[model samples]
Structures are given as structure tokens and as C-alpha cells.
Target: MAEWVHDLGGSRGFGPVEVEPGEPPFHADWERRVFGMTATVMAQGRANGSEFRHAIERMDPGWYLASPYYEHWLTGLATLLVEKGVVDREELEAHGAPSFPISRAAARADVPPGAQADPFAVGQRVRVRSFEPRGHTRCPGYVRGHRGTVVRRDGDHTVPDVEAHSEERPAEPTYSVAFDATELWGSEAEPGATVHVDLWHRYLEAVE
Candidate 1:
């Protein structure tokens, strides 16, 4: 059997979960370390010194839930590396086996603005444009093609898909958009329900 470590929220303490020996660890590569480091830097940059820690504390509330741990690690690592420039798109591709450029000369004409471009504001109405979905997609399975309004837009950041695979193209800027739960789930959904997700600018279109 394999043992996993977990933190109990609110100063309770850390504990272990036992699993079958052949079972895979949640974070096979344990990439969360990189993610945590990057998050810490970003938090400090935004004057939210304890933001990352606070998020972690809120997420783990005693009882353990089964989830794809490595996915979380990958998500966090991709975000941090791109944010801190520890792993650029070109570098990631180089690290991958037999690297090849994913972008064409036309697409490589210029560098796109990322987090350093401009600040995002709230109450912006946006629509997600349709695109060929491939690799890992952040555009949640449930919200595809669904019309919604942006309640809040978090600071700009690099898209994580390219980073996760080390694609040759540079990381594109992404925005955190919030949608009304009713809009996505329809009239049957709770009146005040809502869901927030990070989406790259390329994935959205401004709808009047």
C-alpha cells in the first residue's frame, strides 16, 4: 500500500491516506513545487502576500476527496512557470523530445501581449469563440458554446495549454472570466449560481 500526505485545515495538522500499492500518486512529477514558487511571487507582486497559502487552506477542509492530483500539479506548474518566466514556450519545446516548432512564420510575426499588457476590469460581456479543441482544454466541457457575461476579470496571464506540453509557440495571455451559473446551466440552475474560469483572449470575442 502507498501512503499519501495531506494537510488538515485550520491548524488541525497533517495526516496520511493509504492506498493500494500499484495506485499512482496524485502528482506523479510533483510539479506543484514550481507552481507554488511562481504563485508566491505573483501573490507578492499583487500585494496578496498570503493569497496562495490562503487558497490552499480553503481547498483542503479535513476530508480527502479523490481527484487527479497530477492534473492540479500540472495546472499550477504551467501557470507559475509562464508567469515567472522560469519556463518560456520556446524553452519548454526544447525540453520536450525532438522539439519542433508548432507555429508558422505567419503566426511568429510578432510577440503578443501577455500579463504585462493591460489590466482587466469587471462586468465585461464576452463570448467564447469557437476553435479547434485539442490537447488539454480549460474551456470546461460544460460551458462550451454557452453564452455568458464576465462578472470579473482577473489579471492577465499566459495560457497554460502550451506550457503544459512545451509547445514551440510563445505562451499567450489568458483572462479569468466569471459566468453566471444560470447562464451556463440554464433556468433550472440555482438563481445565484456562478462559475469562474480562466480563458485566453484568443478564445473570447466581445459581444455587444
Candidate 2:
């Protein structure tokens, strides 16, 4: 079965990808315009990166399939600008393009106290929570409900889960966890194989 828009990773029914090495960033002139506009709006702090991605995620799944890569970015940018009151349909239709000044506060983001203390230390065994989240998340689908050993501590930073919905960037200690490929996949995976994922502390709990 295919998971809809929110549930990416470990889902089925994706087409095979053809990698084009040394490909230019923009394939067409319209792509360049879209990319530049998105970049400018983001650089000006109309919305944060989390909100930008959440905008894309908010798109109808059917719309998502029809959109090309840069089109998604353009959609995200337009959504944020309109939703945040930075721009409106009238201005866009009349002016053709829009730009706004970024606030100083938006430039240097503030950290929220989302983390009290680190849960699992280095070399500790932890299992990822299996439940699906209703909101935006950074956890990869394949790693959920699986156990891994913490190999490194990435310190504390903004949690994307909350950041997507609000202005706050809640802090959480991130970790580099190593999972045996067999655990995440199955015995079908090659023997002695492993995968490393950088996960937030909230996604994991002590295994023992």
C-alpha cells in the first residue's frame, strides 16, 4: 500500500530514480526564477525552513505528484508568503513578483528550552518509538519501532516537529544511532550490514 503525503520513507509505490551526475541546479529558465525567488524569500526571513517544508507537505497529494521539483519549492514559497500575510493574491497578480524585508529577529533565531537533560548517553541501547505522528517530524519511517545503539551525541538543537507548526524551535539532544541492517530491514538484508541515523532524543527511549 502507498502512504499519503506525510508518510514518506519506507513506503511503497515509488518510481525508480535515474541519477544524472553533474547536473545543473536549474534545468530551465522558469526553474531558475522559482529557485531564486524561494531563496530570496527565505533569506529575507518571511518564513523559516521548517515552515517552507511544511508548506510543501501541506499540499494535496495529487497536486504533489503533478508538480516538478522546483514547482514544489515555488508552491511552498507562495503558500508561506500568503499564509503569513507577507503577500496576497492581488499583489502577486498585479506585480508579477514580490519581495519583503526580513526582520532582524528572524535573521538570528532564538532557541527554545525543549530539552531538559539528555536521556540516553553514548553507547546506550535505545529503541525508536513506533507510533506515527500527526504533525511534522524528522524521524525516518524505516527506523521507527527499531532498536539501535547510540554512537555519538549531536548536542541540542531545534526540534523540527514543533518548529513546523509554530515559531518556536524547541531544543533536543540529537544522537547518531547505529542499527544492524537486519533489525531495520530483515534477514533478507546482507549479513553484517548496518545503518546509521541521526535521531532526536525524543524519538528514542532506553531499551533496557
Candidate 3:
């Protein structure tokens, strides 16, 4: 049995686990378009579904606190259709594709690489350099310009920021870098404030 854990929003713990293979991959631009549309609807107080709204209302604070903005967008989309009556539980199970569809041309451009990035060795000193911030940045608002050792590096995957925008552009590779909690949050943080953020290769540099 394959059990999946998801954070719906709010303070309650993760809800009943679902058994599944996993979600299919999507182009970065498509994700962005979905997010932008969802935000627009939300701003208008007309989000798509009721179950989605309820899930959003119940999402765990911890997941909500740590997730990227676009992640919230993806989550919202999943919840909305169910609540709105656009899709049913049985329909969801039977449907081959997700509610939002992407063009075939776009799909071809977003395939994952045959090879993946390797994990970082423990205790390696690394630095997070500043770049012209745009679209979406996984580096927390508090961690820019901060120096920290590379606690770990979970590497080479499709960059979510770009995939979130697949409707407009192409998906690219992103690296997941883990930083020591102390480096990002300072000594006042709890014993485990370590944060692992997915960063594009373009966002990093080596420090002397």
C-alpha cells in the first residue's frame, strides 16, 4: 500500500492518508498560469470548489508556513474542484489527467532528466548569494544575504518556479539546498530550525 501525506492548510494534523503512485509532473509555466488564475479567483471570492475551500481552511500551519507560494496554488486547485462539484471522488480516480490540461508541445519540453543531481556531503560550507529576485524565490524572505554551511544538497530536479509557469515558458532544473537553522534563523531559533529550499543553479555561488 502506498500512503501519501498532504498538508491541506490550518492547524490540524495531516488528514487521512491516500494510497496512490503520485501526482504526474507538469511544466513550470502551466503551474504558474494555474496559480495566477487561482489567485485571481480567490481575490474575487469565487474560488472553484467547496471541498477545496474547506481543505484550505483546514491546512496545517506548519506546512502552510514552509510551503512555497505556488505549492499552495497546486493544493488549492486540487481541493477546489472536489468542493465545487466539478469533479467527484470516483471521477478523480478514473481521470487519467488532472483538471487543468497542458498543450502537447509544452508537455514535450518539460520532461525530467535521465540523470539527477547528487546529495551534498554533510558539514560542507556553502553560501547563498543574492540575485535579481523575480517570479518566485524559494530562499526565504529572512535568509537572503545570510551565510550558512551546506547541511545537505538534494539536487537536480525540475525547478518548480519555472514549472509553475509552464503555460508561459519552459521548465528547468532546480537544486534543493539545505541550510543550518542557525545560519538562516540565528541562534535564537529552536534546536531544529534547519530549512531545505529548492534553488535553481542560477541562484548560488561559492564563497572564499
Candidate 4:
């Protein structure tokens, strides 16, 4: 599927960003509750950060746009809680969560074999793979199929693309890929502008 307008990418257009001269951390009491609950649930280990983000990414396009930022967070967090059997829709809709345990499978799942390779080095030219993912993916919509230079090797870490789907932990090296603004935004982009995106090894291919 093509990336939606809501997806973080070059194609997504935003009206002028609103500036808050002095913004409070949260706008309202409910927003605070939503933020706090999401944090507490993730901290309790009922869901990992990757899974929560994926849930948010998978939200319906209409709902995603129609809701406020914190509402989206609440929606994703609630969905994970129910899906993990921590709470049911009735309880969740009632604005109450029953007792829930941290997922042992998530903390102790065995790492996938042969997932620690670190072949690419800094300053290497690589292209983001053009894969339309049906599952949770770390690759951003903007950088797919674009070539960029590996500006930094961010060391190896657990791959979230797989972890979002299951308890399995697969590790891989990550890098910061720097792309010229023109390459992504066209010649109209200001000269000397660029964008840096952190990408995992699986998202990149060596440029010969």
C-alpha cells in the first residue's frame, strides 16, 4: 500500500506550523491522563515501544486525521492492552483497566540467529529498499527507494520491525542515512539542504 498522507514523509503536506510562544507540557487534564497512561503501560512492559508505535501507525486514516495527538496515543495504547489480553473492550471503553502483568515473553524471547552482521560502514553509499510493508516497519515513508550516504553507524540493536509482530528479538546494525534535500524534495528545495534519517541495516542496500 502507498504511504498515507498522515504518514511521516516528503509527500505529506502540512499547513503552517502553529507556534506556541510558551506552551505547557500538556494542554488539558485528559491529555495528561492519556500521556501518563500510555507511558505507565509501556513502562509496565505490557507492550514495547515498537508495538505501540506500530499500533499508532496502523490506525485508520480517517480516525488518525480526525483525532488529536493524544487521542491517537490513547487509541493505540488501548488497542495494545486489549490485544495482549490485558484488558477487554468493555473495560477499556469504560475507562478502566483491569490488573495486567508485564509480558515475560517480550523480555526473554530468544534473539533470531545470524542477526548481528555489521557490514556497512560510515560514508558508504546505500539505497533504501523499496518494500511496501504489510507489517510494522521502521523504515520511514519519505526515504524508501532513495539513495543516501551512511553518515553514522549507530551500533547494533534489536530490530523492531519483527518485534512489533511477536515476542521474537532480532538484532541488526543501524545507521544514519543523509540525503540531499533536492534528492527527496526536488530542485525547488533550498540549496545545501539535507535530511538525516536513522535507518536499520535491513532497510538499506549497498550502492555499487
Question: Per-residue error at 202 for model 3, in Å?
Answer: 2.4
Query: Model 3, range 1-208, lDDT digits (tens) per residue?
Result: 0011231112235577555577544447767677677767667654423323334433444565576556655555655555556666567556544543211111122222222333334454456554333223333444456555555455455443344323334333345566777876577767776777655544455456
Q: After superposition, how far is residue 33 of candidate 4 from its true place, in Å?
A: 1.6
Q: Which of the two candidates, 3 or 4, achieves a greater TM-score against the reference?
A: 4
Which candidate leads in TM-score? 4
lDDT of 2 by residue, 74-145 (tens): 777877787788887677656654542111112222322344545678999999877566556678778888
Relative to the true structure, how large is the alpha-carbon lDDT of every model? Answer: 0.46, 0.73, 0.47, 0.74
What C-alpha lDDT, on a 0 to 100 scale, does residue 120 get in candidate 2?
Answer: 76
Comparison by TM-score, 1 against 2, better one: 2
lDDT by residue (tens digit), candidate 4, 69-169: 88778878877877778877778646554532211222222222333445688898999877776666667777888999999988888887788878778
Which ten residues in a row are the worst by lDDT in model 2? 100-109
Q: For candidate 1, write residues 111-139 as lDDT tens digits.
A: 12233423334566777654433333344
Q: How do all models score by TM-score?
A: 0.41, 0.82, 0.36, 0.84
* Superposed model 4: Cα runs more than 4 Å off: 96-118
How many pairs of residues collide in model 1?
A: 1
